[model samples]
Target chain A: MGNEAFLAIGIFVFTYGFIIAEKIHRTIVAMIGGALMILFGIVSQHTAIEHIDFNTLGLLIGMMIIVSITAETGLFNFIAILAAKIVKGRPLALLIVFSLITAIGSSFLDNVTTVLLMVPVTFSIARQLKVTPIPFLTSEILMSNIGGTATMIGDPPNIMIGSSVKSLSFMDFISNLAPIIMVIIVVTVLLLLFIYRRQLHTTAEARARITDLDPGSEIVNRRLLIKSLLVLFLTITGFFLHQTLGIETATVALFGAFLLLLLTGENYLERALSKVEWTTIFFFVGLFVLVSGLVETGVITRFAQSVIDLTGGQLLPASFLILWMSAFASAFIDNIPFVATMIPVIQDMGNMGVRNLEPLWWSLALGACLGGNGMLIGASANLIVAGLSGKEGYPITFMKYMKIGLPVMILSIAISSAYIYLRYLL
Target chain B: MEKLFYMVNNELITLTEHRNENDFEFLIHTKTNEAADRLRKLREFFDSDRVYTDILFYARKDHEYQVIVRRDVYVPFVVHLLQLQLLKSVEWRTV
Candidate 1:
């Protein structure tokens, strides 16, 4: 390693420390680090530009727009209300049903937004049923993360992974990860039910009240809901055709966003566009460049070699190592940047003659997604749910969340381990 | 009518501005007053219990200014006040 490599490593460490400490805004820290990489000539301006995965950014922004517009239609709330009505205020049944709803919703929509939409309604139902909302809220958070593993568009990390590999399509994700996620979700739901079985009882009056809930009133605008759903359906169809149509996922997503904007009117365009998480998009940009600097300096290659040595050149052990490492690291740090950095290292392993890189990718996806439920601060959806619950006076403390989240996370990863071994190895 | 007040450190510190909802854009000088006086007057304002208020601290200027909202109307109120509202860095604590 040369002085340039040292400089890049120093800057990368500083940026990551600030992000982990959360003293300074992550975007600002990342932007500063990215700029320093350019100033030091570690990565040229043109090289930095090339390093950014615009497909990931475009897909994120486009989906954000679609979700924002769809949010206004009150479709998510309507779905929540419908779930509550189905269970008729049975606390255990309500928990399972709502978790299923959240899982299914998150499999298509972003997990954070799905949880955000579902939480308030969960709280309301809990209030009416006179039960603590912790179990239901916790279940939803875990299920969202679990469900988010099922597709490329389901989670940001999956999107990044999908975009990084040409062979991995949206359909491939659904076909492979979806089945595993379904089994894991069932196991998780069952575990949570066993843990919270005592708290599942509710009053008869509350049950009657839930049955009385009119889900129709939750829809703020019928026409907008119909249109949004139609466009969303079309966008998803486009995703399934990701390879067949020879169109990038980003292009398909952007097309869907534009089509939605046209149908929804340009007047509302500004509002819809404003709702996109620009900070997150920019965070990706900075992270990509920073990781590119490491890759350019051969640091990632060295790390990959060390990992391969640690695994003794065996594919199964390497997959397990990647899976567990991703899970535990992602439990504390933001998995977006963590996964961003890991993708290159994994690819380096592939370049080093590791056959069937697909298993490694699945492990990374499963670990990053499932491990997010290990702590309240692990994922955006967890934090959003915690914040809402806290505001309502049922604060989900870090320790409190981990008490349930950590073990469940461990169990889910264990299930993934077996699944990976059975499906890919042996 | 719009009720105007300034707060710091989780305490309603002063009443430097008062205006109707239409006059919300009119800035008032609350910086010149002593912190204690501001706190005292703010206490007096809330003493009457005229309406429900939710204290919302600006995320950036953490100690600078807090907008008091009646009931849970802070979001829409802030949105309307800012016109082009961006929830970029705002960490809303509904206390």
Candidate 2:
């Protein structure tokens, strides 16, 4: 009704339109919306930048550097090789091992890291086995989201969700959802085996083609490797000790990375810096400004209140409500920005006496994250993996990813929803 | 040791500062003495034949590198050396 509300609608409209047309990059679209919000005086410039969530950025950057070092060490490669060796050329066994390892990494770190660190290595093994790597990658990506479901720091959405709700913790992930996470992992592997069985290499020639086949490797620098591993170990220790030591995750990670740079002794410091995707970071800054405008315009708060009333202050029904909407929204909207805006909506739901709606937070996080894999433009990790795959000569068209990704979305959401309902509600 | 030839743009590939673990001799198409010398040395290291007791170059075509692996064990060891070489070379070309 007010000028601010009008402006907010305009920003949202522009964001959606810009994204849909593909005329502007998402960072630019988000930046434009955020800039417009500030220009219209919907939110002050300070809040616009301030709301961008540097915690997420810091965690991501810190982890990327650490993961890069680990990747360079060929630890990930060695792990995949171990899986391949342990599977001993069994397609289904390799699928399970690969998926489980990827899920574990994704849960602790994030999907993009897990994927980046795992995919190429997976590709190498798949090449050796003379089989298609798609099923393994698909399962990995899906399991990544599902695996991220089990841990607070596993996914950005989970981190955001956890930070917004205090009843949850790093430990809570292991205690509350570990069983369900395991269930999803088992189901995911089984589903992948079934879905891709026909594609499995059974021909005698193809079978022979895989035995002791070639995938690339790197020259091992034991000094560099040991040094990098030390830094990584320290980083993990710092991360776990934070609650008692009263340290921040970002500070620990940043400091650890700095130490690694000092000790790595190679030119990888600069190379590593180049590896950080500032594009995604800027996108975050831009999206925050855009979402802040929506908040400033009072539209978001109003929307939140109405939704709260509609749910009759019941968290159980609200959990379902948020689940479906978040899933769909995630399919279309950028999950980071979506998660950013929903922080307030979640608070609004809380204010309406949705007691222990904390589990609802998990649903929102898992739903959006898993649902993000639904479409081409869902998650940052999706775009990254797609681009990486393409760079490696395996171009992943939107249609192709969606073919597998869509079914993955449906199954993951159903499983997650059932888990949340059973865990939280009657 | 064995030499496997992988000719990339007419210049033989070499991993300058890394240890060799494969027997590969190859010609790659490229212009640079460093590239040629590196390739030749790699071939010598990997070459089991020991054909060249003297220094000479073939008159035509491109540069070739000789790469040799120190031992024989499989599971993509040679592939690793090739990837590292390719990855470094590719990174160099791009930068």
Candidate 3:
């Protein structure tokens, strides 16, 4: 390795250390690291700009706008209340339904936002039933991660993967991963139900209170709800056909977002844009340039070669290794940065004679996304839910969560392993 | 504690006190969605959890709503009402 390679690796390691330590805000750390990369001539300013994936950033911003506006319509609350009433306010059923709703919502929206919308309603339902909200909260956290695994836009890892590899489209993600995700959701929910069954009972009168809730009244604005739903449906349709139409997913998402803004008038423009999570957007920007340092230095290429040598240049063993490693790593640390680094490594693997890179990509996606269920600190969604629950006087401690989270994560990964081998490898 | 009735902004606000063995509950009937939304937003600002707070909002028929305020949250709730300009003034008494 030359002097530039050494500097790049040093800077990369230093930046990653601070990110993992999390004492400083990650966005600031990443920005400074990315600046250092350019300052040291590890990567040129032009090259750094070239490395930032606008597709991922645009898709995130666009989806954030749409979800933020849709939330104002009170549609999520209405759906939660409607689901609770449908199941006759049974705590066990409420748990299952809420988990399903969260998983479904996360599949199409950001996981943290999905859990944020679900937590308050979950607490309200639990309070009415006079039961603990821990089971429901925990289940939603796990399901959000799992659901996010099933689509190109579902999880950040999948988004990065899709943008990096052009051949994997929205429909491709659904066809490839959605089946397994459905199975994982069913299995995980069943396990959760069995574990928390004893604590899910409530009084008959309490059940009646839920039934009395008028779901229709939860719709805060009928006109806005209709417009939001129409645009949302159209945007999802655009995603399904974007590949076939030879257009990028980001184009479709941004088009939908602005179209909704036009219809809703200019008043919503500032409010929707303000809610676009600029911190997360900047975090992605800094990470892209930081990783570009390693990519340009050829460090990632050499690491790829070593990984192939370790696995004897075989696809099956390599795929399994990525699957398991990603699961455990994602469970403990931020999966976004991990996935960012791994994308190029996997691409380098493709160049180094890994004939079928399909399995590797799928393994990475499944592991990085589902692995979030391993611990409370595993994903942003988990921590958000924990924070909200703690503020409500029902803290989901690390150990308390892991007692259930670890086993479920292992079981889901096991199922994913079997599915990958039987369907793709074998 | 007693049942207190007042008029603010041409709207009737009734506060009914229900005494438990150890704690007291104040049911503040706002009787309109506009006031209910304001109170709910205030409660949300104070307590993000929305349910476990000393204040809870219940929706009644004809767009009417009632806010259940516990003793601990009474002062802040009253202060919010004053700030929102829904309450004119709070008279102090030596109960």
* Chain A only: TM-score per candidate: 0.98, 0.89, 0.99
- 2 or 3, greater by DockQ: 3
Error of 2 at A254 (Å): 1.7
Q: Considering the true interface contacts (CA pairs under 8 Å between chains A and B), give the fraction that model 1 also has.
A: 0.00
Winner of 1 and 3 under DockQ: 3
Models sorted by TM-score, best on top: 3, 1, 2
lDDT of 2: 0.67
Q: TM-score of every model?
A: 0.82, 0.77, 0.93
lDDT of 2 by residue, A257-319 (tens): 788988876688888887777777787778767877777677777877887789887777788
Q: How would you encode candidate 3's per-residue C-alpha lDDT over A58-160 as one tens digit per residue?
A: 9999999999999988899899989999999999999999999999999999999999899877877887687999999999999999999989989999999
User: Can you tell me which runs of candidate 3 are displaced by over 4 Å?
Assistant: B1-54, B60-66, B79-90
Find the candidate with the highest lDDT and give its number.
3
TM-score of chain B of each: 0.24, 0.32, 0.60
Question: Using TM-score as the measure, which candidate wins?
Answer: 3
Model 1 misplaced regions, further than 4 Å: B1-95
**Which docking category, incorrect, acceptable, medium or high, applies to candidate 2?**
incorrect
In DockQ, how does model 1 score against the reference complex? 0.02
Best by DockQ: 3
